[model samples]
Target chain A: METKKKKPRYDFILILILAVAGLGILAFAFLTGGGGASVEVSVDGRIIAVYPLSDNREEVINTPEGKNRLEIKDGRVRVTDADCPDKLCVNQGWISMKGQSVICLPHKLTVKITGEEAPESKGADIVVK
Target chain B: MKDNKGKNNIRQKQYIRSVTSHGMLVAMAIVLSWLEAQIPAFFAVPGMKLGITNIVVVTALYKMSSPSAMGINILRIILVSFMFGGPSAMIYSLSGGMLSTLIMILLKKIRHFSITAVSIAGGVFHNIGQVAAAAVILNTDGIFWYLSVLWFTGMVTGTLIGILSSQLVKRLPDSLFSLRSGGTK
Candidate 1:
């Protein structure tokens, strides 16, 4: 028998790189997401309503397909119920961070947490470089 | 004339064999898609799926040609959409499937990337394509935030699929892919 050298079969380093990249992106997303001032509801891409996070309220969004119950409480918003088939939006639970959203694909409805204009920034032409 | 006839016979056999295998793989893909849908959404994040059908696609890519894998994926998405999904769902799946398959094919050409790495790329791109489609259709960028969560889940599911398909590629008899001894190249 002759001794032979074999090349490594798996690219484990690639997997590690991807894992770290994914985690880094997730951390960035979390760190940059928060301080939402209001919850906005939209149907068919049109803004239907905007509610302040300070107020706890329940509202129903009616789309061409069906109805979705949007609930905002304690600065977080969620879809409590929907007539859509998958009910994925309802399952999405609550989201409070800015840019977070609960989307009902079937109904074409979206409940999103948005960072409204800061009071100081309102009616001010703040220049940025 | 006799030699030409024999060659034609072998070619016909190979064609039949390839067709049958493609059909079987497509059926498997459709079944996997359906089975995945049956599972309740355990995660609280939207656009999250176990991507069980990806196992079939990855197996096809390694066992067969790129076109075969792409065809199986597209056919499965269309058929499943007809049965269980709506027009919007079809659009999302089509975009995701096409993008993922394209990426996997490109990755397969490179020597350093293993099957798992290719699969992870496929999974991640699939989510990206879907989210892009959603952002376009829904006319909002807020939902793009889901990409953060989806990328993580894609990597996890892609690893599982890559491992499973690698096993299948190793264990399955080559005769399953090439029935005739000396068929097509």
Candidate 2:
């Protein structure tokens, strides 16, 4: 006896639901990019420092994995340089908008822009690190 | 004595066939994973993957027993991580792989959803596991904020994988799968 193959059926409703949900989240991520006044830097998930966007300075972040140079100027922040192999963070460019972040996965470091009024909680408004 | 010998011979042949089939699936999964790693992330968000490897996992789940599918999935993660990634990568992949596999298995057992739904759930759970691992390693709750975006990516990728796997399974020859035992439905 031949074992008949079953034809695969797709649930269009499930796909539609997922598509709507996905688009909603993507929209939220983009729409929330308001101007931010401060940038918070974290290494190994701990907040190392918070620099005001009003200040123009370069700070070198050193962690056990590697080192990264963060440059803050003109209300924008970016990783100017890093020793990590990919250097993805350096290429991510500057972010001065709320909910924007620059992350170095190799070094497990993250820099995020925050509003002038720091939230009492240390958690990020949007986790992109 | 003759009957026992014949049965033993058939069992040995089945075992060899099963191992070979599982090995082929693992190799396919590894190649897909490697291919995915070569493509630059489309989104700026970290840890985003196309999840093409999931096609093999989903196919395995439907075509073989839960244990066989799971064994193949775990083996693929370990081998791929060791070959292409660092210790941290291994941890993240392991966490994600295990969680996704568990969710898929549960969903499969329920039989209420289509393969696409199961794959989507697997994708979402995989991201959650990775985020949880990152949060623990980094010691920050900040990573949780990334979950929303990850979930969005997961659903999109998962749906694609689900469609691909369902088609692949339909095309596969029944003889390639062990018919003697260790298959559900």
Candidate 3:
């Protein structure tokens, strides 16, 4: 009877390398800023967006113009009736999560929800666990 | 005729043909990912669409070794992004493919489970990976709602691809390929 060698041993070594590499990357993610709590953005019953809670955000009112009239009333977002067409800001429901964004293209106004900025200065959407 | 089975020394080269080798597998995977770009996977329910490329990922996982599958996956995501999937596909493809491969390979180690089972496991893991990425990107747990939908899709697609791969692998000649005489050692 003829004999045949088993499949090449290359696969075992290659798998080891890949596994180690994958684990290394995961570990790096944990060690880096990824381990930090994430950010979420919501608008009333409908969630428009979500993003990291990093400080890399700016409030429309915080700008030099310093005129931000958008606010949350009775758990609903109100645009204070800006000059935006379709009154989209009025359509935007609420901002109770991270990364939530409501744009009023015509009025040149927007409502953004982020982790660092919420009802209170301290982050409330996320409980670090 | 039976004598040909053991005597045809030159016929033992199909198992690892260069065109079907790991590199080719990687290239085809990339091409599959790129080609899938034209397809409209989104049902318009939300920002996310149903990812169909997991079919190819599951198939590749079964036909090739774990590392080879990983190789194919990484290349597919990179090449697909350069071609059509844009940043969104890049993120989901890489995460889904990587984690799926991990689950498929680990399941392959089980003695009794078949490739179909491996594919199911891969699909589940792929969803897990996608959801994880979604969580990271959205930075919120609200995106978890998408998992149930993905799981249903995964089960069906995974089974189909797994069956196809198993049949294909079965038909392949179980032997090591030899380099062509004109080819170098």
Candidate 4:
């Protein structure tokens, strides 16, 4: 039979690419810890506020955006309500671990996990740069 | 004219298949959506909840078409909202779901990409989509700030869903169509 040169089908390409993307995502997740370090957001090393995942329940964290309610109901910390526009920080569910942070750009307040320390920064100072 | 007519017939047949398949997808999306809601948010941020919805959305995107996934997601949202959650969850789900669907679909088509990349892309897009949705729904641009937070979470969660989906696809081949085939896209 005279054969026609078949065109390349992209269905498999989509699956392979999705699989790779999944791998990349897996790498990032495994590398980063979901169990974030407990951090106190502050200005100039002086922790103006603190959010401990173990705190159990919503606590008012004083940020640049006035008094916003932050909670640790499940296994992470999240801003329940913020005066800041967009309320994005409030929408972000939970944060627990390295490289994870909750930011309120409009309010200039950032709650982030710097690292796992010996609780020095806990009682010391946390300055926002 | 004869050749053109033949091509038209083929195109029509393909369209019919797509439409019917999409309907089935919507039904499956509904089931998945319900299942998604039942998954207790592993971590609860008051006014927010988390689950494996992203994985299903990403998996569907990988296995099916973009519009098909989108349709399923939309149906899932409506059904789940009706079955559980209030109008609030629906708002966030719509924004995040649509974004995840669009981004994953694009990344899946990217050259030399992997499911890992698609998963991460899904994570990032899910955040962007939700933040955008928040800004629109809340009518405030400040929502973008939460993007950083969501980004990290997305990376973490999306990867998990991706891995799970990958494993699932391996165990369940395409033709088996009878196994829990409540697929949306």
Candidate number achieving the greatest lDDT relative to the actual structure: 1
**lDDT for each residue of candidate 4 in B1-185, tens digit (9 for 90 to 100):** 99999888877766666666656666666766677555554443312324366555655665565666677787878778777765756787788877778777776666345566576667667766766765564443223334544566666666677788767655554532322233322
The C-alpha stretches of model 2 lying farther than 4 A from their native spots are A1-37, A91-100, A114-129, B181-185
Q: What is the TM-score of chain B alone in each candidate?
A: 0.95, 0.94, 0.72, 0.70
What candidate 3 gets wrong by more than 4 Å, as runs, is: A1-129, B1-20, B42-63, B173-185
Write model 3 residue lDDT over B1-185, tens digit each, in one string: 77897556545554346345656656666665555544443332222222345445554555445665677677777877777655755786678778888877776665345666666566656766876765565444333334544555555566666676666655543332223423322
lDDT of each candidate versus the true structure: 0.82, 0.79, 0.50, 0.58
TM-score to native of every candidate shown: 0.89, 0.80, 0.50, 0.49
Candidate 4 per-residue lDDT over residues A25-115, each given as its tens digit: 5456446544554655643234565445444665666654476676665556667788864576676556666556565544545566544
The Cα error of candidate 1 at residue B42, in Å, is 2.1
Task: For model 3 chain A, give the 10-residue run with minimal summed lDDT.
Answer: A32-41
Best-to-worst DockQ order:
1, 2, 4, 3
TM-score of chain A, predicted model 2, versus the true chain A, to 2 decimals: 0.73
Query: On a 0 to 1 TM-score scale, where does candidate 3 land against the true structure?
Result: 0.50
Docking category of candidate 3: incorrect
lDDT per residue for candidate 2 within B149-185, as digits (tens), equals: 7887888788788888878877876677855644434
Give the candidate number with the greatest TM-score.
Answer: 1
What DockQ would you assign to candidate 1? 0.40
Scanning candidate 2 chain B in windows of ten residues, the lowest lDDT window is B138-147
Best by DockQ: 1
Residue A55 displacement (Å), model 3: 30
